[model samples]
Structure formats: C-alpha cells, structure tokens
Target: MPYAVDFDTVSTAGLESSPVAPALAGLRANEARYFRNKYAHVFAVEPAGDAPEAVDWVHHILDAERGIVISSPALEATTFQVENIRMAYVFYRSGLSINVMYTVDDGGKRAVGFKLSDGMDVPDELASFKFARQRSKLAGTIRGSYFVIKNEY
Candidate 1:
C-alpha cells in the first residue's frame, strides 16, 4: 500500500498571546462545538435540589491536571476509575478530596472526555493545581497516582 503524510507543528508555550494561541483557541472552540452537538446531554450540572450549583469544572481541571503535571514524569498515561465521587476527602491542609472518574466507553471503543470533580474547594491564587494521591483503603498504606494535563496550565 501507499500513503501520504501531512504534519503541522508549533510551540504552545506563549499561550493566549502567542501565534499558536489562535489555533489552540480554535481547537477548543471546535471541541466545544462537538461536545455541544454530540454529548451535551451527557454532561451537565445544576442546583441538585437547591444545594446550590456546587460543581466547579474549572477548579476540578485545575486541581487534577496541575497535579498530573508536577507529578513524577514516569507516571503519565496511566488510567484508573476512582469511586465515591458524591463525597470528598479533605486533608489536614484542608484541601478537599476528589475522585477523578474514568470510564472505558464502548468497551474500549475509545476513551471518553475527562470529567472534572463536582465538589471541591481549593484556594485561589494558584495558577494550577498540584497534589498527591495517597490511597489507603486500610490505614498506613499509600497507593500510587499518575497522570498529566498537557493543555491546562
């Protein structure tokens, strides 16, 4: 068989003011359009019976993605399905806990969009979130955490 290849590359370092910013913005717009068109219904949040519209997707992404970035370099690309998202676990530092739920849609058909935490209260002033995930079902045992958010900063 024969094939042709086309590739485009650019730096995404400067962010909003950079030359590549528009492209990134365009991509994000396209993603939003696609999400609205196809999966809008699958994603949403509300007052939950007047508890106050509590989920902050932005914060969730900041926290989770930031954690992923500063974390050990070898721990990217791993996946897991965290549970009990309805509740949270706040540490002694007062940062709330969260479950970054991951699902294998269509039985490996493709990975689904990463959803942010519905409930959490981390302090502002941090450009992005960075943290540790020490999971111990029983006391004194620390599980491992690994992942990264490339687009978020």
Candidate 2:
C-alpha cells in the first residue's frame, strides 16, 4: 500500500494550530513562494527513509544537478529518529561521503536551523547539506509531495 503525504500534510506534520503553525500560516498569508519555512527546514535529519535509501536519493539528485559549495564528492546521510527536520551544510566541501549522526537544532519562530555539534562525525564537510536544503525545498512543493528515484531516463 502507498501513503499519500501531500505538501499540506508534510508541511504541517509536527506543526498544527499552535502558535508556530499560525505564525507560519500568517507568513504566507498574502505571499507567493514555492515553500515557506514550513517545510524548508531539515535539521539534523533522516531523509524519510532508511539511511542507505536517503543517501541514494541525495546521490541521484545532487549528482544530476552537480553541487554547490561542498568540496567533498558523494552523498551521505545525517540520520535522525524524528521526521521533517532539515540540516544544512555551509562550508568547504569535496568528493566524499560522511554521516553526522548527532546534530543540534534550534527551532526558531519561523525558519528552523541547526548546528552539527562538536564531537559529532560528519562524512563530508557540508556541500551536500547545502544541496539537500535546496532540493528538499523544491520537493516539498509538489502538492501531494513525495520523492521518487529518477534512475530511468
């Protein structure tokens, strides 16, 4: 059986009628952006699947588009038990893959952000994180949103 997790559901998964959701709702009240802060954050995240599966998705997406600032090559998963959180990469990167298992998160009033704390091990510097942020944001915009491997072209 397949589950249908749409943009609406996906964006509002952990958030609801709380002040947070309402605040987010208000931000987009009269604006037009593909995805607001609602689903744009993947703090120290697990990519909604197994570690290997997530890494594969990252590889396919980033490999096709090339990369941003990451010097390290290859994609790696920074796993988490929670869902819908976004993690970011913000520095020198290259061809490589490393998993940062633990990440520190600070959920702001609107946009959520995170920091890969000390002692935590990340496979790559963070180039992939940068890419993931952009990719996931676009992904969340697909109405009834979901990700599929585009290996067959």
User: Top model by lDDT, which number?
Assistant: 2
Number of backbone clashes in candidate 1: 0
Q: How does candidate 2 fare on TM-score?
A: 0.21
All candidates: TM-score:
0.24, 0.21
Checking candidate 1 for backbone clashes, the offending pairs are none
lDDT of each residue in 1-153, candidate 1, tens digit only = 111111122222222332233333223233234334554411221111221112233235545555322121110111212231222111111112222333334222111122111122333433243533332221122222224334421
Off by over 4 Å in 2: 1-50, 67-153
User: lDDT tens string, model 2, 1-153?
Assistant: 112223343342322432333322222221113223444422332222324554544444444543423343222233333233333221111212222222234432112122221222333434234322211331222111112222331
Candidate 1: worst-modelled 10 consecutive residues by lDDT: 70-79
Taken over the whole model, the C-alpha lDDT of each candidate is: 0.26, 0.29
Alpha-carbon shift of residue 114 in model 1 (angstroms): 11
